[model samples]
Target chain A: MFLHLFIVNKSGGLIHHRSLSSKAPKLGTNEWLRIGSTFHSLYAIANEASPVKLPGNKKNGADDGIEEIQADGMTLNCFQTRTGLKFVITAEPNTTAAVDLGQILREIYMLYTDCCLKDPFYELEMPIRCELFTQGVENLIQKYSRIR
Target chain B: MSRTPVNILDRPLGGRGSRAETQVSLSAFSYLYSELVQYHQNRVDSISELERRLESSGYDVGLKILELITYRNREYKREIRLMNILHFVSTQVWKAVFGKPADSLERSVENTDEFMIIDYEPLTSTFCSVPADFGQLSADGYMSGIVAGVLDGAGFSARVTAHSVALEEGEANNNNTNTSSSSGGAQSGNNGSLLPPRKEKAVFLVKFSPEVLERDAAMDR
Candidate 1:
């Protein structure tokens, strides 16, 4: 089961946050902001701090870092766009076996572009308050979470 | 106004852009371009201002195309480095927009932040007939904005500008073979071999911002 989802903009500002289940931690806006910025800087530092230059994937950059982190109960998967937007999701530790979190993140991205970007009132990199976007993401998550 | 009855979201966005890939005639393009130039011409007092207006118009187009291509091809979103993005721009972006790859891509020896992509017959400049009073303005200024928009959207945040310079001797030969038309014979008189090559070349100069260079330097360290 998915626990939480966060959409962080390129500058590490928390643009959207949703707790998928009761098991998810309830983070205040300020706390989520702090986490988003912290993760942003940490992601950069982690990319630079790698002890070895990874044998690069031609499809991916050599500087990519911290894709998935597994804990005792939960697994956090991050899918980063070239523009540095982050879609990080926390789910059950074994969910990777049953679910493709990366694909879900990609779908969320498509939803974002479709709903948020196409909205003329929506500005770039701002907090996404679009009802359509919120509903679309919720629908997407609900569909995947229902699968088992 | 015949329309596909399906909802917008249900229909695929252009479907790899193949089915809609019918060619736009040169006359239609030039007419549209002339109208654009005339529209902007009425608003601006100076040449640079006119170019800036055109550039900004292309900026949104670049962003839209970037998002569309990224959505169509998944591997593109994984690109994180500078050079890889540039390669993608020179190949994929160029082909998507112009129907062919650029003539050549090169880095400036004088500046680490600057790179150049040369196009022999840029779609923007080849048939564009700017008036004499427009001074040294090139229609490729709009093309530069598209490049800037794509780079900025990709997190590179580079400034791109286009310039037309003298084409080299060997470059003349390369251009003819690459293009389907063997119109090179008409480019010059009987003394084409002895004289220098034609000067119809457009170079797009991309200057990376300091912040982006810092990130790149940090990556290398």
Candidate 2:
């Protein structure tokens, strides 16, 4: 089951956070911000430490970064866009639908492009509080829950 | 440790991959645009205000897309000429947004500063239906903003407006007669008959600032 969702900007700031299940632990806004920055640093460190190198390049790696992490009976999956915006989702440890999570992340990205990026009222790198975005996310969560 | 600032031009086009051609579902876009319109409609008191909001939104998209498309075309240098920029907007930018080039690009015979970019079916207004009371509300204001953005980004300040010109059979004949008497008689005569039946057509009217024309003259000299 899905537990939480977090969107981190390239600057390691939390742009969006949503808790899917009521059973998920409640964290203060500051705590969530800390998690976002921590994860971003970890991602950078992982990319730096990886042994595999890109086919044509010596410095960059083909490892698309740390996509999934399992810890404390929970799993965290991250999907990063070409622009460096990251979407991280937390799910139960035994939840095996990695592909579905990726699809969800992509849909979220599309919503962000349209509702947030395209909006004149929305400032760049600001927390996404657009009503349309929230509605789209809720719809996606409902659809996924119904399928399960 | 000192780090050199990353130059955007020095980086690869798609960051990691060679050239990533990304696509969003049309239905998804339509829904989002509809919501955007509805949101603006509720807040604004006037039709022009609603259009202005839509235009500003499109402007932001246009500014980002100008950089992106220019970057994507690795051989593209900065466009300086008026005609070249218009061609870029009607062809490259239109294709990037709507998956096809504009139907036609025409220069106004009566006005030297005016140009028209025709789209047989503009994506932004395809699903939109203006109510009878809405009074000449063209959903293509967003597209106009995009055109304006492209022009402004290329150093040509311009005012772009969208007009729905889907004339009925009888009205087309009347328009043809009226145009035949005007300065652009031959061009209008051909345009009226060339369009297919029953399809919505939008014309983006672009009027460049006077300084742009002066610059063009100086460049020609």
Candidate 3:
């Protein structure tokens, strides 16, 4: 089951947050902000910490960096786009639904494009609170729950 | 939790209204714009008329974009000078719509009232290719309309038109040579080199109203 979602911008600011399950622990807004920045730094660190120049491999060793994290019976999956926007989702351990999580993240990205980026009244790099966006996320959560 | 439902369009767009970092696929936008051009093409008798329709459509968008961008920039005191507005359009507006600033912004050497913004490969024309017989038909009319709309919305009152400029064979060859030299081995593997050269250049000409010049002179005094 999905527990919470966080969208961190390229500059490591928390642009969005949503909690799907009531059982999820609640953190103060300040704590959430700190976590978002920490995750951003960890992503960079993970990329740099990749083993240098594997023998016989022409491609960069860090081609695919820090994609998932497992801790305390929870799974944190991170998907980074080419433009550097990060989508992080927390789920129950042993879900084995990485593909599903990626699809959900992509769908959320599309919704953001349509509801926020394309919006004539929207500002760039601001917190996303569009009604359509909220509704779309909710719909996805409900759909995923039923399927599971 | 019963509450009066508000129309989505009426809601505020900025601040905490929605997430602003979303992006749409370029292919989707290209398809939609192609249909828009085709729709206008069927309804008009002449190229100019078709362009007019496109400009009008873009004009509406420009007005809305101007407000949105201005609000986002927090520029409560709107730009009043002609050059400032043009710069804003060429840089800020271009980035907002196309994800990059315009390639060049130049004042017309022959006409003092005229200015030009050039985009080497316009987004609207990325997927469009006009037939040989169709003289001077470029999909950049939409961009011209956008420029006009932004100018008009900002009280500059200008006329904007899009023109296609075919690159000379020598210049085209030079460009290709430069690219080949830089990439060398990568050129052979690139698929883009296989396609024929289409209309890859566009110039948006903006002519400000005479009153704007008069106002500028007064301001200078």
DockQ of each: 0.01, 0.02, 0.01
**Runs of candidate 2 exceeding 4 Å displacement:** A1-148, B1-21, B168-199
Give the per-residue Cα lDDT of candidate 2 at A62: 27
Cα TM-score of candidate 1: 0.50
Q: Relative to the true structure, how large is the alpha-carbon lDDT of every model?
A: 0.73, 0.75, 0.73
| Highest TM-score against the true fold, candidate | 3
Instruction: Give the per-residue Cα lDDT of candidate 2 at B215.
Output: 98
Give the fraction of native contacts in model 1.
0.00
Q: Which lDDT tens digits does candidate 3 get at residues B69-139?
A: 88887888789898999999999998777656787899999999999998776667653545445677766
Tens digit of per-residue lDDT, candidate 2, span A23-112:
577998899999999998999888888777566644533244788888878888889887778999988876655337877787777667
State candidate 3's DockQ.
0.01
- In model 3 chain A, which range of ten residues has the least summed lDDT? A114-123
What TM-score should be assigned to candidate 3?
Answer: 0.50
Q: What is the per-candidate TM-score for chain B? A: 0.79, 0.77, 0.80
Write model 2 residue lDDT over B1-221, tens digit each, in one string: 88898695675433335222243444456667777887888899998999898888898788888998988778479999999999999999987776567878999999999999987667676445465467778888999999998889889999998888865555332232332222122322343222223235788999999999999989999
The runs of at least 3 residues in candidate 1 whose Cα sits more than 4 Å from the true structure, single-residue gaps closed, are A1-148, B1-23, B177-198
